[model samples]
Target: MQDLNPTGTLHIGASDLEYRMIGSAPADAPTLVMLHEGLGSAALWGDFPDRLAAATGCGVFVYSRAGYGASSPVTLPRRLDYMHVEALEVLPALLDAIGFRRGLLLGHSDGASIAAIYAGGVQDHRVQGVVMIAPHFIVEDISVASIAEIKAAYETTDLKSKLQRWHGDVDNAFYGWNSAWLDPKFRDWDIREYLAYIRVPVAILQGADDRYGTIRQIEIAREECYCPVDVTIMAGAGHSPHREAAGATLEAIVEFANAVLQGDEGARGRAA
Candidate 1:
């Protein structure tokens, strides 16, 4: 297979997923696969992937799931277990289709939960570690409340127009994520059960003032995951740490990624 990094569309399952590669994927260095947030896309990630590749000297692969960015759209009335499907079916297929050798998964918000689920559900040895930013283990009332606010913003404010700049079909991107989270049945959705199965190292980054969820999400991982678990709580930061505290978040992730890729066990040390 060619080792060149390319930006293009991949035909996976019934959808055409959009992705871009940063840096080369050599045998020695592991790649970093970035999964975007609920309303986020590859373009929305901005220069984070580039900065990460330069900082950690690891290849970075970023993609937009179906219904976001330039990818194909999905049907309405998405299942409440949408994240589960993404983890079990779509994510694994994406890794295989991309010829993934060894890599770390970096995910944000909904992406983080999806990454955690994938790590626990799939026993793929190629996945050395995972970096979850603002992950949710179990649904919270605060999460539902904040999601409700976003839905209101989408309708009343220019949030939709702003998101349209990033997503190809803005409604597909917004409603697909919004409708599911706001669904009353989704409150019972929980992935903490999968935590025990995660054998690889896990690093969790969350903001101190996040409106979507509280630190209980992190506690679940520490209690359930037997593997090395590293946690970081950014001071004065909100839901999106990478965006709210970009410098600090980037530094931590770069350090952790380098350590994990180098097979350093002590990298599991916690930070605040």
Candidate 2:
């Protein structure tokens, strides 16, 4: 595993993912590995990672997936099961590459879905909990509509230019995610089955008025997850609660991380 630096590139297979590390490293503290949204890059997370590291006293790692940010570009028209591929393939290598000893997977939007899939599909004991922000368990009509609208905006409006600020291959990043979701076959994209396999505690932060997904995402998690599930509906917030209600979001995650990591420590002590 490479050394954890404040900012660096991690070469995973053919992709060199861009990453940022804040506060202590995973060897000295429990880490929070953050997965960005579909169009989000490592830099797009803004100061949330820094605030999270300060609040929780845990290392916060943020990385941009392939085709996003400064990462390597992927072939256009991503597969319908791209999230699954990320969860099963990329994430495991990423965790190992980072020398992650103990940590929680924190994800937003597509990133959230990837985290959930990993927790459920892979039995990695290093991960003790999950924090999902605006996660989607299944494809919703609203999600399709919003994605379609964004595709239109990307083509005819300044959305592409705006996104270009974060992504190196702006078109690849936008079209890869946009084309896959807008594909008719993507309507059947569902990952609720993975929820049942997640062994760690899960915390979900949902926006009350998110345009992309509804409360049903939370409902699916409640129904599918056998582990402890904590849900916080952030009122007056939109799709991105950490961006829209930063303080509340940080507090909620900090509280959950403390409780979960402390409990894990206690359990380890008893075992010892």
Candidate 3:
């Protein structure tokens, strides 16, 4: 594996992915690999990565997938199984490329779903745990409605202009995610099977009033997962708890990371 620069573009498969490394390298400390939400990118994470690194004393790696941020653009009308492909194919290559040794997979929204799929599907031992924020196991009526609403907002409002600040191909990022979710066939998109296979501990941070998903997501996880499942429902927060309830969300994640990754030599060294 090649050494990761603090900030650089990694050429993975056909796409060039943008990434940022905060604090220690993977070899020196446990690395938290952060996967952004559907409309989010590395830059869109803002200072959360930096804060996570400082709090846990672990390396934080944030990256944009193929169609997001400064990464390469993807073809229009992405596959309905795009998240599955990303989890099974793309993420393994990314972890290997970054020389990921040990840590948690921290993801938000679509990113969270992808992380869960990888953990349950891939059997990668390097992934010590998973932190999922607003993950969707099955498409809900509310999910499709919210996505449709966002599509309208993106077209009529200045949402596209705002997103352009983070994405090189804003339309590609927006439409790729938006179009796939809004597709009628996507209603049957379910990943509950993946939950049954995840061997590591799982932490879910959810917003109580989230418009896109409901408490049933948490219920599904509880039903399917045999591994230890930790749930925190943030009362006032919405879909993006890391952004909406920054302090409490970080505290929950930090506490879980320290607990699950306590056996990691690098993590122990960092704490010392």
Candidate 4:
């Protein structure tokens, strides 16, 4: 519902999903598709996306996932494959509908997992690269413990009201992500097997003090991803690097984007 100027809004699905797109560039400028965190939305990005779009000369786009911000709430119970379905089916359809054939992806937390799956499944050469911020390749006990704490905080504190400001309907964003994660059957979820199959370059960023997951998650990603891997860790940052250490996170990502945008511009540059 927010106007992002150059890149207009659109209702993209049967659910009337509304998204905010920012920046304008040549059709050839690499698109930067932003995927938000578990309880995040377009507004929750809090100028991070705009700063990123300005830093890199790429177009930026972000949307509230179903049940997040302005997007419609989930109509039914979600299965374990919810993330996979979003990556494999919804993302592809969204890109095709919006004319984003080639782009670099910037995904945080759960979103990072989706980007990895999409990059591996779709063998498009134009898919450039990925920058995963605090990604989870496998579930960790630390994460579970933190989730339990969060649930407790929600029950006994103002956490729900605080989140409700960002998401008008608190339960939609809260339970949709919370229940899906805490489900007993969800422990079997893992995306590591797809890392080795990812052909595009990947830059994995993690915080040394991340509360959601530990450094082990990024280590798992680096160990499994066969392509060129760049791992960065910000000492004092937590689950949200962009907010915790914006300068460092942006600096690192700008460097990565430059390399990705360089592409074939070195020798046989393909004009788009």
What TM-score does each of the candidates earn? 0.94, 0.96, 0.97, 0.91
Task: Kindly report which residue pairs in candidate 3 clash with one another.
Answer: none
How do the candidates rank by TM-score, highest first? 3, 2, 1, 4
Q: List model 3 lDDT by residue over 1-272, tens digit each.
A: 87888999988999999999998888778999999999999999999998888878889999999999999999989999999999999999999988888999999999999999999999999999999999999999999999999999999999889999999999999999999999999999999999999999999999988999999999999999999999999979999988889989988898898888887654542221
lDDT of 1 by residue, 1-272 (tens): 33334798888889998889887653434789999999999999998888887777677889999999999999987889999999999999888877788879999999999999999999889999999999999999999999999999999999999999999999999999999999889989999988999999999999999999999999999999989999999998999888889999998898778678776332222332
Model 4 whole-model lDDT (C-alpha atoms)? 0.79
lDDT of 4 by residue, 152-256 (tens): 899899999899888867787887888888888889999888888899889888988998998788778778888998999988999999899998998888788
Instruction: Judge candidate 3 at residue 139 and give its lDDT.
Output: 97
With a 3 Å backbone cut-off (N, CA, C), the pairs that clash in candidate 1 are: none
Error of 2 at 110 (Å): 0.2
For every model shown, the clashing-pair count is 0, 0, 0, 0
Off by over 4 Å in 1: 1-5, 26-28, 263-272
lDDT of 4 at 229: 89
In the range 1-272, model 2's lDDT, one tens digit per residue, is 88978999999988999999997777777899999999999999999998887777788999999999999999878888999989999999999898899989999999999999999999999999999999999999999999999999999999989999999999999999999999998888999899999999999999999999999999999999999999999998999999999989988988888888885442121200
lDDT values for all models: 0.88, 0.91, 0.93, 0.79
Name the TM-score of candidate 1: 0.94
Model 4 weakest lDDT span, ten residues long:
263-272
Q: Which candidate would rank higher by lDDT, 1 or 3?
A: 3
Q: Clashes in candidate 3: how many?
A: 0
lDDT, residue 218, model 3: 96
